[model samples]
Each structure stands twice: as C-alpha cells, then as structure tokens.
Target chain A: MIVAEQKPLNEIKTMIADAERVLLVGCGTCVTVCFAGGTKEVDLLATSLRMSTKLDGNGKVVDEFTVQRQCEWEYNEPLKEKLDDYDLVVSLGCGVGVQTLNEQFPQKQFVPGLNTAFMGLPTEQGVWEERCAACGNCILDKTGGICPIARCAKQLLNGPCGGSQNGVCEIESDVPCAWQLIWERANDLGQIDRLMELQPAKDWRTSRDGGPRKIVREDLRLVAHEEE
Target chain B: MTTSTNGYKVGSNLERMIRSGEFVVTGELGPPQGHHAEEIREKAALLKGYVDAVNITDNQTAIVRMSSIAAGAIVVQEGLEPIIQMTCRDRNRLAIQSDLLGAAALGCQNLLCLSGDHQSFGNHPGAKNVHDIDSMQLVQMVKNLRDENIFECGDVIKEGGPRFLVGAAVNPFGDPFEWRPYRLAKKVAAGADFVQTQLIYDIPRFKEFMKRVVDMGLHEKVAILAGVGPLKSVGMAKYMRDKVPGMIVEDRYIDGMTDAITGIEPLPPLTKRRKALKAQLQELGEDDPARAEIEAELAELAPRIKEIQAERNKNWREKGIQMCIEQIQELREVEGVAGVHIMAIEWEAAVKPITEGAGLLPRPNVGSNGSG
Candidate 1:
C-alpha cells in the first residue's frame, strides 16, 4: 500500500495563507492503513488549520470531507458540488489521491497535505516498512521473498554489502540488513542454491528510473464509447 | 558483457596494468576525517612510488572525510594513479554522475564503485539515506557515461563522458556462500572491469569462492583483486570479528594470540607476587636477609616479565605480517585471481611492508599504456 505523512502544520499553514476558505480531502485506503492521511488525520489537520488561522486573525473557514478512495473519480464526484465553497482543496492522501482530486475538478487548485513515502505494509502496530519498489521486475523468488530494492539501504540486487554487521545494517540501530535477512531466509527455506543464479542488470525501462510508469489492462478497457 | 579491449578513453597506470595482464597491486587511502589537505598529500607521498594505484576512499564508514575526488586529485599530484572511490550512501543519481564527471576532469581514471556504509554508523544518525541506486547501478552508470556518452537520465554530455576502469566490491565470506560468485558475475555483467572484495580473513572459504569463480570462467571476463590487510593487534582482530560486519574471523586466529602468551609458564601477576612475598616475609621475621632476598627476586622478576611481554608483542606483530604474506602467496596461486587490494584501514604505514613482504614491490611500470 502507498504510505504518506501529513505535512507539518507550519508548511500547510503557509501554503493556504492567502485562501479564505479551505477543504481538507482524505483517502480511505493506504493512507488510513498507515495512519497518515486518513479521515481522522484530515479532521485533525483541518481543526489545527482553523485554530491557527483563527489565532492569527485570518478568519478563514476550514472544512473537512473524505472519500472512499480519492484515487478513483467516482468516489470524488461529490466534490464537484462543493467547488465554489472553498478557495483551495487540501488533500490529506497519497500523491495519487491529490492528483485525482485535481483532475476531477480542473478549475480548482489543490495542495497536498501529506508527503507520499513508499509502497509498503505495516510490519507491526504503528510501524510500517517498505516491501516493494514497484521496479516492475521482481526478483523476490531468488531473494527468498525479501525485496532488496525496497529494503536494503543500497538497493543492491546482490548484496549484504560490507556494511552489514551482525545481521544489522550500518544505517541505524538494528535495522536488519535486508540482504542478511534474505540470505538467512533463503538458507532456512533450503533454497540457497537458487541465489547462485545471476540476476541481470535490471531493465530500468519498466521502472520509474526510466520514466514515469504506467499500467494498462486491454481486457478491462471500455468496450464501446458513449454516444457523443 | 562487452569486455572493452578498445582501451580507456582516459587511461591511467592502473588501466595499463590491467591491459598488460600483469598481477596488479592497489592500496586504499582513507583521507582524514577533517578537511586537512596536507594529510592526503602526506599519505599519497608515502604510497606514491610503492603502489600501482592509490584508492581514495569516499567517506568510508559514512564518517564524512575529505571527498575522495579531492584526495585522489592530491594523489595524482603526487605522481600516482588514483582509484577514486564513489559510494551511493549519500548522493542521489544526479550528484553521483556529476561528481563522476568532476572526478574525470581531475584526471581520476580508475573508479571503484561501492554501496557505502549506512549513515547511521556515522556521527549523523538521523540523516536520511539517499541510496538512489545501488553499486550495481553505479557501475552501469559509469559504463553508460563512458560507452554511451550519456547520463543515467539520458542527457548527453556536451563534453564527452569520463572513461573509467570500473571496480566493484564483493564479499566471498558472507552467508549463502554459493551466491558469492554469481554476484561477482552480475557485477561483471553490469560492466565491472575489476573487483576488490571485503577484508578476507578466512582463507579456506575465499579459496573455495575462487574455485567457483574460476569454474564459472568469470576470471576470463573480469580481473579479481583479493583484499588483504594486516591485523595490527589482537584487540583489532577481535573487534573486526566480533563487531565488524561481513568480516570472517575464525576462533583459531583469536586463539592463536591467546596461545602465544598462554604457552609460557605464566608468572603470578605483580600484585599477587607482592602480596604473597609480604605474607611470607611476615612469617619468617621482618629483619631476616631472606626477606631481602625475596624482595630482590620480586624486583628482578618484574624486568624479566616485561621482557617476556615485549618479546610476545614482537611475535604477534611478526605473526600478523606473516599471516598477510601467506594470504597473498596463496592468492598468487589461486586461479582466476588477478592481484590483491591492500586495505590497511588506518594502518597506512604497514602497506609498503605488506606489499614488499608479499613480493609486490617496485611497482610495475605500465605507465599510462593507451593501447587496446
């Protein structure tokens, strides 16, 4: 899931300083799971913005609204009615959600309330860790299902670089070297021999490093256009 | 992989050595942790005439030091080829490529691409890591710049790309042993012209890795320089083994140090000897000449003990030098091995002797051979 963190109060306040009214938009998907840009976050931020602006004597009218999934156009269709009621829309969601809101209402300007982090799952309560880089070429089968591209500090395809000491990365306190974990896991699974296969230099054409990525499912495309 | 025999666009003596097919010897130089320009010059001066190329480490262990480019430039001024080490721990892709260009402009032709130690290990624990690409990509990026005359972002270099004899780091002793060689093959496939592995203390495992490397015919594809360094002290050896990561230190090596001192019939430590002598003197009567005899013997034993410990210290130092000589000799016979990368860590003074003792002295004179 895509994770995000809400922008600091000062930055958000500065971004909406000139606006007289504001709308805080939240996502109900990945952001909620990561405790970043969920409904509760949106409410909390909206209240803070109102309080800050009120304290500053700006007298701005702040409002809160959330959609089931801000990335989908259907879930954001209701926002068309509330367009003229606010000067700016603050999206408390992933970057995709903010872009979606902007595309849904082309005339209104939207600002991101949160910074998108990565695509990962929560490893524990309130602790999220990245598991995939969306590199489009997955080698998890060879690495015993551990994603070095996402987890290793170096993103080394073949790693446990010299910096891995005592099964932990040199990066921080006990951040297990992803390659160390992969090595041990592969050893435990009795699939250590599979790692001997040389993984080629990854074709970056499928990754964001090459360009902005896109996905298309021909089978799911609209079969026919509506009557124009 | 297109093993480039077309010769380097900007060549160095190290490239010449690789081209000449003579066993090469390179040594690492970690610039001072602070910005003292003269320190690099001093190190480069000490190493200039003794090594084929001097590798200037880039903030090794993530502690910010004089930039490798700056240090390498200093080494260049000292009349030695410098292998400018670049790491992905701190820089993004843009900065990495830009820095490579700058390094090339400074006449750094040999490049050692590494995924540097994590920043948390440095003084700045809270700094965000910027591993925009791994060392594999860094190698590919160097190749891309040299071969394609373009950046990783596909931007053309108005002034031609930097030609580099690229090297990458490999670990032969790390777990899932069989994968070690395959990883080497991947680095070669990514355009690594040569490789220098992590500090190797486990000779048997390294020998096995070399055998696998030879079996795969990787030696024919790329030059492999085995890493060797002197263990200055027992504490140093223990720290590297018990604390340092990716280091393989067998118990026998540590036990060897303990055995050296323990082999002697151990004398009672000074405090114990003094207390025992005092009690014995009180039992005999305070004025006895025998008490003076015991005191004289106790005083004499201190000097003898000191001499024994001094001899033991010399033995350990010689033992360290001997260990390096044996490792290098074994590596010289290992099929698929090209040379040795002497990593003295902070012990730069040992490099000349290690190289000289290993019979790698009077550095080869393949000076800037620009031919294919």
Candidate 2:
C-alpha cells in the first residue's frame, strides 16, 4: 500500500493562506488505512484550521469532503460541483490523488496536504516499513522473496557490502540487513546454489531511469472496429 | 627478482610480484578533498620504495575528493605505480567504462573495483547514488574489456582498451561467516586477479577464512592481499571495535594501546600545574621561605610538560606501528596469504615505518621489463 503522512499544520496553513474558502478533501483508500488523510483526519484538520485561523483573526471558511478513492476518476465525481465553491482545494491524499484531481478538474487549484512516503504495508500496529521500490523489473524469486532494491541501503545485488554484521546493517542496528535475510531464506529453502551464481549488472531501463513509467494493457482497452 | 615468467596479465609491478610468488605490499593513499596534486605526490613519495603499488582511493568514505584516476596519474609521475580504486556508487556502466579508458590511458595499470561506502555515510547525504552495477558485475565487465576487447554492452573496442590488473575486496569478518569464502570465489570467478580484504584484527577468524579458501583451491586463482592498518590510538581501536560494522578489532590491541599510555595523562601538565600553584600559593604565607621552593617547581613545569606529552604520543604511535608489524609478520605465515595492503589512513608516514618494521622495505625493483 502507498504510505504517507499528513504535512505539518503550519506548512499547510501557509499553502492556503491566501484563500478564503478552503476544502480539505480526503482519500478513503491507502491514506485511510494508514490513518493519514482519512475522513477522521480531515475532520480534525478542518477543526484545527478553523480554530487556529480564527485565533489569528483571519478566519476563513473551511470545509471537508471525503472521496471513496481519490486516485480513480469516477470516484471523485462528487467533488466536481463542490470544487467550484472553494478558492483552494487541499488534498489529503497521496501524490497521485493530487495530480489526478488536478487533471480531472483543470480549472481547479489543488495542493497536497500529505507527503507520500513509500509503497509499504504496516509491519506492526503503528509502524510501517518499505517493502518494494517498484523498480519495474522484479528479481525477488532469486533472492528468496527479499527485495534488496528497496531494503539494502546501497541496493547491492551481490551484497551484504562488507558492512553487515550479525544480520544487521551497518547503517543502524534497527534495520536488519536485507542480504542477511536473503541468505537465511535461501539457506532454508535449500537454494543456496542459486545465490552462488553471479547476478549480472541490472538493466535499469525498466526503472525510473527510463523516465516516468507507463503501462497499457491492450486487452483491457475497448476500441471501435473501423472496418465494420 | 625473477622477470615475468610467461603470460602475466597486465604485468603491473604488484601483479608481477604476486605472479612470481613474492609477497607484495600495497599501500593506500587517499586523495585530498580538494584539487591538491601535491598532496598526492607527497603521499606517493612516502609509499614509493615501500610498497609495490599504492591504491588511490576514489571518494573514500563517500566524501568527494580529487578523482582517483587524476590522483593515480600524479602518483605515476612521482615514480610510483598506482592502483586506481573505482566505486559503483557514483557512476553507471557508461561512466565506469569511460573512466576505465581514461584511467588506463593515464598510466594506471591496477584497478580495485569496489561497491563504495553508501553516500549517506558521506558529506553529501542528500545526493542520489547511481549503483547501476555492483562491484561483481564491474569485475566481470573490466575482465571482458581487458581479455575480449569488448565493452560491457558487447560492442567491439576496435582500439586500445583498458588492460587492468583487476582487483576486488573481501571482508572475512563480515556476517554469515560461512558465505565469506564463497564471496571471494565469486569474485575470482568474475575475473578478479587479486583480492584485498577488509582490515584483519581477529587472526583466528582470518585463518579460518584462509583455510576455506585453500581447501577450495581458490588461493591459486587470485592473489589475496590481507588488509592491515595501524591502530593510531586507543580511541580509534575502541571506535572500530564498538562502531564500525563488518570490522573485528580484537580487545587485545585495545588493551595493548591502553597499556602504551598507562601512566601518562593526555592533558599537558600546565593545567595541572596551574591548579597546583593556585592551591600552593593560597596555602603558603607571602614571607615563607618554602614558597621559593614551590616557585622553582613551577618554573620547571614548562619543559617537563612538553617532555611528558611528547612521550605519551610517541609511546602510542610506537605501539600502533609495532602492532601493525606483528600482524604483517603473522599474516605472512598464514597458508594462503599472498601479501599485505597497509591502509595507514591519513598517516602516510606510518606506512614507511610499518612496512620497514615488517621487513617489507627495499621493495623489489621489477624494472620495466614485465609491465604490460
């Protein structure tokens, strides 16, 4: 899941300081599960902005709206009519949602209220750790399901980079070395021979190095038959 | 010294020394953080007759410095062979190949391919690193360029290509101890000609690593240069022992360094004397005859303090060099050990004494015969 956190209140205030009517739009998808930009968070932020702005003697009307999924076009249909009522729309969604809303309503000005952190699932009750880099191509099968691209500090393919000790990374004792986990997993699966084989230089053209990525599934697209 | 017997690749002085079964000593020279060619020359001069080839580190510890190839060129000018260190952190394959051609064109014959320290550890932590290829792939790429005359993309060089005495690094003390020897084997398979290890402090573990290498017959495939460095001080030993990962600094050296300055205080005695004189003057009468004796003692404090501080530093440094010499001597007796790579970081002058103390001085004059 895409993980993110709400921006600090003061920074958000400065972003919409010039506006009179502010709409705090929340996404009910990834941000909702993560407790950041959900309906409850948006309500809290609206109340804080109302009270804080009133305290500063420059009180502006603040409102709240929640979208089922901010990333999808149709899920944001309820926002089209209401967006015109506000001078600035604050998106309590991931970066994609902010861009999506802007693209959907070209005349509207939207600003992000949360910082999109990474694609990860919560490892514990309140803590989350990144699990994937979305490096276009995946090599997890060979590494015993461990993603070195996301976890290793150096992103080393043939690593544990002379800095891993006692299964911990040199960067810190809190972060377990990815390669150590790979080694142990490989050992458990009796696939040590696979790791013994040298992994060649990675082809990064599939990654962000190839520029912003796009995918088109021909099978999923509907088209008219020109000949008919 | 025996000339290159036959088919010595690159034939660098360090390579030839290894091929001829002579225990070679290679020293490290970190380039200055600025454009100071004289710093390279000065460090090169200290390592000139002491080591076969000095490694010019590339942005060592991730702090930007003069380019290793540029520094290597300067070292070559100072009458010493240079092993140019290259890291994958800052360059893609294109830059790596371009720099390899540039380095080879500039009289650098030895190349130590490394996955550099992470940029987060350096001054530019905000910088984005380009680990386009790992060090293993780099080794294979350089090998293909040298032997097959092809680039990493499989294009024909069609002209002069970099002919490097390829090198890599291993950390025998790194975690998953069972996999360390296998990592060396992988480097050897990837076409590394010589391998230098991370600093060795725990000799028994290193012996275990070497036994595995010798058992697998890997000792015959590549020259294994054990990394050794002078301790410098008790603080450095403690830092490496407690902080630096993948490093194993035995407590014996820490205890030994502590013993070196057992009785001497690190602080100069003037501070001590100031306190003593203040108390003595406060306690004594102005007319007392014994006050003259205390004044005479204060007068002698200046030179005595200097002597004591100098003695403390000398003792610590002497112990550091002595310990390094002892490591070298013991490493030479190991079954599969080839030579020692002394990394006297920022202490270039210590390289001479460490090498000399280890009986590795008067480095063999291989002359220009076997140089590729």
Candidate 3:
C-alpha cells in the first residue's frame, strides 16, 4: 500500500491561503490505512482549517468529503459535482491519488494536503516504512523476499555494504541492514546457492527512470476504452 | 617496494609500507567542522611520526566539515602522508571523479573509497543521498580510471589519471556475520588494495573473519587491517555497544571495566534504588499516598548513578589506550592481519602515546618511495 503523511498545518494553510471556499477530499484507501488522508483525517483537517481560518479572519468556508479510492476514476466521479461548489479542492491522498484527481478535474485547482511518502505498510501501529521501490522488476525471490531496492541505502544488487554493523545499517541503529536480513533468511532456507549468484547490472529502463509507465491488460480492459 | 606504483607518485609512506609486506599502521582524522587549517595541521602532526599514514575523513557521520582533500593537502604541508577518504554520499559520479582528480593532484596517494555514512546520521538529516554508485562500483571505477585510463562511461582520459592505492572499509561484525567475509572478498575482487574493517572489540568474531579471509586466499590479494580504537570511557563503551552499527564491544570488556571500577559483588546504588522504587510502586498500586514521593526520589537516583559512573570513567583514558595496545598485540598473532586502523575520534592527543606504547614508533618512511 502507498503510505503518505499530512503536511504541516501551517504549510497546508498557506496552500489554501487565498481561497474563500474550499473542498477537502480524502482517500479512503492507502491514505486511510496509514492514517494520513482518511475520512477521519479529512474531518479533523476541515475542523482545524475552519478554526485556523476563522482565527485569522480569512472568511473561508471549508467543506469535507472522502471517496473510496481517489486513484480510481469511478471512486472520484462523485466528487466532480462537489468540486464545482468550492473555489479550490485540497486532496489528502497519495501522489497517485492526488495526480489522478488533478487529471480528472483539470479545470479545478487541487492542492495536496498530504505528502506521498512511499509504497510500504505499517510495520506496527502508527509506523509505516517503505518496503518497495516499484522498480517494475522484482528480485524478491532471489533475495529471500527483502527488497534491497527499498531497504538498502544504496540499493546495491549484490549484498551488504561495509557500513553494515551488527545487523544494523550504518545509517541508523533503529533500521536493520537489508542485506543482513536477506542473508539470514536465505541461510535459514538453505538457499545460499541462489544468494551467491551475483545479480547482474539491472536494466533500470524498467524503473521510473525509464519514464512514465502504464499497464495495459487486454484481457481485463473494457472493449469500449480500447485504443483506436 | 621502494618505488612508484602503477605509474603514479607515491607521495605517501602508507602505500610503501603495505607493499613492503610490513604491517601497516594507519589512523583517521575527522577534519574539524570548521575552517581552521591549524586545527587539522595540529591533528595531522600528532599522527606524523606515529602512523605510516593518516586518513582525512570526508564529512564523517554525515556532519558537515572541511573537505578531506583540503585537509589532506594540509597534512601534506605538515609533512605527513594523507589518505583522503571519499564517500559516495553527497556526490554524483561526475563530482566524485572530479574530487578524486583534485585530491590526487594535491598529492594524496591513498584513497579510501566508501559509500559514506548516510546523511540521516548527520546534522542534515533531510539532505538527499546522492549515492550515484555503490562503493564496489566506485572502487572498480577508480581502478579502471587509474589502470585503464577510462571513465566509468568509457571516456578516455586525455591527462594522466589518479594513481591511488585504492582502499575500502569492511565490517567483520556486519549482519549475517557469515557474509561479512564474503563481502570482504568482493571488495578485494573489486580491486581494493587494502581494507580497514569496522572497529572490532569482539576478538573471537574478528579471528573468525580473518580465518575465513585466509581460507579464501583473500589475504594474498589485499592487506586487511583490523579496526581497533580506544573506548575512552565506560559510557563510550556502552554507547558503542548500544548505538554504533556493526560495532561489537564485548560484554566481557564492558564488564571488565565495571568490575575493575567496583567489584560485581554488590548491586549498583541506582539499580538498588530502581528495584526498591518498583517494589514500592507495585505495593502502592498507583493509588498510594507515598507514590508521588517515590517517583520524585527515583528521578533523583538516576542522575546520582550517572555521576558515579562518570567519576569512574574519569580514569578510563589510560584503560582505553591500554586496551587498544593489547588489541594491537593480539592482532600480531592473528594470521592474515596486516595491521590496525586507529580511529581516535576527537582523541588525537592519545595517538602519539598509544602508538609509542604499542612499539609502532619510528614510522616506516614510505613517503620517499612514493614521491616519484
């Protein structure tokens, strides 16, 4: 799941500083799971914005709403009508959600309320850590499921760097060395043979560096939306 | 051994010592985070006659500091060999290559290629990490530039390239302890002329790592320096044990200091007070009238305990240096161990005495051999 964090109250306030009427939209999917831009968060942000704007005598009217998933067109169709009632729309969603909303409602001004962090899960309550780089190509099978692309500081395909100390990364003690985790898991599975194989230079063309990527599933796509 | 290597000026004694099969002694200088050339010159001078070469650290621990190249040049002025440490932390390949050339032009012959400590570890936690390439590739690239006269992108160098006796670091106690040796092997294969490992207080683990290196014939390919440094104090020991990544400060070593200071027969006063407070809290069940008083006393006891430990640690400087000397002696017995890299961070004054006590004085004169 994509994890995001709400921007600082002051920063968010500045984004909507000149707006007299605003619609705050939250994503119920990834943002909700991480407690960033969920329905609850949207209400909280709306209440705070109202109080802060009132305190500043900004004369702003803030309205709040949440969609099932802001990244999907159908989930956001309901907001098309509500967006026209506000001078601006503040979206509390991951990067994908916010971008998708902007693309769908091109005429409506959308200010992001949350900073999309990364694609990861909550390791524990209130703590979400990045675990995947969405590199398009995955090597989890060879690495005992630990993604070096996301975990290792340098994302070296081979193994741990010299900075790894006592199962911890030299970067910080709180984080585990990704290669250490991979080696231990691989060792336990008796898969040292696979682990020993030096991963060749990755073709980064498959990653975001290659450019904007899109998925086309002929089998799943609706015939009406097929390319001309 | 008493000549130039790979067609470049030695400009340093450390490279000659490594080539001559003499156990090389090296130390690191964390260039002060300021612009005072005297500060660096003073630190370099302290290490001049004691160590074969001194490494000038590059923004170590990610804190901003004077450039290692600048400091290395200062060390050169002070008549000491400098190993300018370069990291892939803040620079892209272009910037990295440019700095390498600049350092070598300044007469720093030895270069320690490292994928520097992450920026989050330093003052600028929010800074972007520009590790355009890992240390392995950096080592390979430096080797290619020096040996093949080509850049990583295969551009031929019109001017002569750097002739660095490439160095890299290893962590014997890094995760999955077993892979530590293999990682060192990869470093050697990648063209590291020498390797200085992370500080090793766990003698058994270091011995195991060295044995593995010998078994793999890695020792013949590169000189392996076991990292060792002073603990300074019991608090420093505890900090390394608790905080430093990949550091292995043995329990026995910590216990040795504690036992030496005060016999283990009696519980520490703080521990006793803490236990007593816990007992009182449990009895009071959060509703007792005396709970507030106990809490207040508990807070007071903590600082008193710290004061006691600090007092004991006041005499730990000698103990720390003695332990370092002992570790060096122990390395002499370990096969495939070339020497030690003393990292006396901010404790530069101790190097002159520590090296003298370890019988490493009269530092080998490799400087002349590398000077063309």
TM-score of each: 0.68, 0.93, 0.81
Candidate 1 residue spans exceeding 4 A from truth: A1-129, A132-146, A157-160, A163-228, B1-10, B155-159, B259-316, B368-372
Candidate 3 residue-wise lDDT, A93-179, digit = tens: 888888999999999988899998898988889888899999999999899999998999878777887667667777777888898
Report clash pairs, candidate 2: none
lDDT of 2: 0.90
lDDT of 1 by residue, A33-111 (tens): 8888888998898888888888998868889998889999999988899889999989987999989888878899999
TM-score of chain A of 3: 0.95
Q: How does chain A of every candidate compare to the true chain A by TM-score?
A: 0.94, 0.96, 0.95
Residue ranges of candidate 3 with Cα displaced over 4 Å: A6-20, A32-61, A64-78, A103-107, A122-128, A136-142, A162-174, A188-228, B1-12, B255-314, B370-372
Ranking by lDDT: 2, 3, 1
Candidate 1: count of backbone clashes, pairs at least 3 residues apart or interchain: 1
> What would the per-residue lDDT of candidate 1 be over residues B1-372, giving only the tens digit for each residue?
223444454466776787788888888899898888888888877777777887899888878788999888888877778899998888888898888878877878889998887776787768877777778878988988988888887888776677888899998876446557877887898889989988888888898999899899999989899898877667878998877767888776776666656665454575477678778877997677788898887787778777766776776767777788778998889888899898878777777778788888887786554322
Q: In candidate 2, how many Å is residue B276 off?
A: 14
- Write the residue-wise lDDT of candidate 2 on A15-125 in tens digits: 999999999999999999999999999999999999999999999899999999999999999999998899999999999999999999999899999999999999999
Location of the lowest summed lDDT over 10 successive residues in candidate 3 chain A: A195-204
Worst 10 residues of 1 chain A by lDDT: A195-204
Interface RMSD of each: 3.2, 1.0, 2.4
